[model samples]
Target: MMRITVSFLPSELLPKPLGAVAPDGQDSGVLPATAIVIDVLRATSVVSAALANGAKRILTFADLEEARSHAMGLRDQQEAVLLCGERNCQPILGFDLGNSPAEYDRETVQGKTLCLTTTNGTKALQAAQPFEKILTASFTNAAAVVAALPHSNQPIHIICAGTDGSITGEDTLLAGRIVDACCKSFGAKIDNDSAEIARRYWLQDEQGQSLAERLRQSQGGRNLDRLGFGADIQRCAASDTINVVPQVTARSPMEIAMMR
Candidate 1:
């Protein structure tokens, strides 16, 4: 019996093999299920774009120092290593790129190894490493994320990478979209109220505005806008724009790479 659990950030109420959707993390008592981390505002969206555009691999880190250490390694091994990340909705002091989907393209990201750290996205990825399998997702690659889900008997968990400590609407919307798809394609059961709310949202439309508009109104979206990242909000909102689902191929030094 495959069950689907959805939760924003991390908590203590639910833990273990039953499945979990968490944005933050738990070292101990964390679930042993497959974890899908969604950062629709920018992080995972940019990951999808980077992979789709031809980036060989993406190394995600919750801490800047660890990411920098890995970046130095990449620089030694490869001629061009792209250091991309954001802190408080702004690019790091010295990075090749910020957390923006539009910035990743065939010309810039192609054949480069990306070392990325983000305020929310990378944190979720690190925390989810204890799961059986880890996946990165966003509305930009929702279809690919769904397609990558295996039909195993194990439960499925969708984690929404919220802004700071709060649950952001954009990530929850993507989680809902994924949950709705899982229910349809895998016949997976939604086992919680949060998942139910997301599923209901996935079934409804935006009325007049787009999914992007809704994100722009969110606190996460407003932060990006205030940081002069209005362009990124639009790019990240477009659904199915990219077709790559980045699955965590390596956990220890965290590598989210597309299966080529």
Candidate 2:
């Protein structure tokens, strides 16, 4: 049976391979599974928009300077490169673009390469390196992501990139939505308590609140609002609008491209 696991936060994720046992009787090594990384409040959303709108590829960096340096190097080679990211919920001062999905419109990102970094999203992607396949998911491309899942028995892990090292409701909610979809579409079974909790959370309604309103109440949403990004919250909360799934196509510089 296809098993699905959810990691509410990157820290909560095991050392990979779900249940692999090492020679010392310890859990270690990589998993021959697919990992979906969600950063609904922004990063993964941006990736979906950028790729869907025509960006050549997105290379993620955990460090702001590193991303800048890499973009500069690519630019020096006469390549179209844009440095994109955010710090403390605002765009980096010298970056060509911020973490907002709106900024990645086709006109700006088409045929260009993006070097991205962020507080939580990029870090979550780094932590998910142990999986055989890494895909980025957000509300914008949720359905596309579900369609990209492998039908084999290999486990599927969903990792949520919470806000600032803490669990955020937005990420968990998206994770739950993915799990719920997998269960319905792939007949996948929830593998653990985290997965079950996430699935339940996604199905719960809070006093008739809309998904966008619920996102505005999340920790990451509030941060973006405080920084004058209220519009971004609505855009990020959009469900399955983008028809592309951004998968990690290269790992040397960690590039993400639309799955083809």
Candidate 3:
């Protein structure tokens, strides 16, 4: 039987060994567990929307410097690569766009490539690379992420890209959404503090609360809004807005595949 668990904020803030758990004595820390990397404020949501909107590919970097270098390297590759992401909610200088799902519309990313770098989201993706599988999740595509998994017996780690490495209500809410979906599929759950807390948050936020309203109250979401990107908040919070789940398949140069 497979076991499912949820790991929320500050988990990514620490360092590597981000967050791992085992179910039924299957210690996932010592083994490769599937990781669902989430950054609900923007990153993962933008990535999912971009891929769904026909963007050639999304290249993720831990910081702007690396993303810039990658962009330069791909200069000769045509299709006009665009540098996109944010730091503390402010758009990265010289980048074509910020980490907003709405910015990835068909008109802008129709046939272009995107080089992404973010304060928290990209870092979470890097921290979970050691996992057997890494998939990006957000409210926009929560159900799709769960369906993208391999249906394996291995434990699943739902890792959130929290605000400044600290768990925010928003990511945990998204994590809980993932947890609920996972429980529905596997019939088991993580009985830990982190998982239970996330479940509670998800239930509260899901109870007729507007997606933007829930996000605006979250730490990351608030900070991003304070930085003049409040509109992005509504974009990220829209449930089921997209159907693609971006899975990290390579690291050296960042490659994501649209699953399910």
Q: Which stretches of candidate 3 lie over 4 Å from their true place?
A: 10-30, 205-207
Which of candidates 2 and 3 reaches a greater TM-score?
2
Clash-forming residue pairs, model 2: none
Model 3 scores a TM of 0.88
TM of each candidate vs. truth: 0.89, 0.94, 0.88
Best by lDDT: 2
User: Across residues 1-260, which tens digit of lDDT does each residue of candidate 3 receive?
Assistant: 55776667535324556344444565565346787888888888888899889887788888679899889889866548889988777787788998778888998997787888888887787777667778888888887777777666777777887777577888888888777777778675564667777877777735687868988988987787787888878888778868887877677777776653
- What ranking emerges by TM-score with the best candidate at the front? 2, 1, 3
Q: Per-residue alpha-carbon lDDT of model 1 for 1-260, expressed as tens digits?
A: 56888867743222343434343654454455778888888888889899999999998888898888889987787557888998887788878898888789899999989999997787677657657788888888888878877787766778777777688788788888899889888888888899999888766867887887888988888988898999888888888878887888987778989955
lDDT of each: 0.81, 0.89, 0.78
Give the CA lDDT, 0 to 100, for residue 22 in model 3: 48
Candidate with the larger lDDT of 2 and 3: 2
Q: Which segments of model 1 are wrong by more than 4 Å? A: 11-32
Angstrom error at residue 139, model 3: 0.7
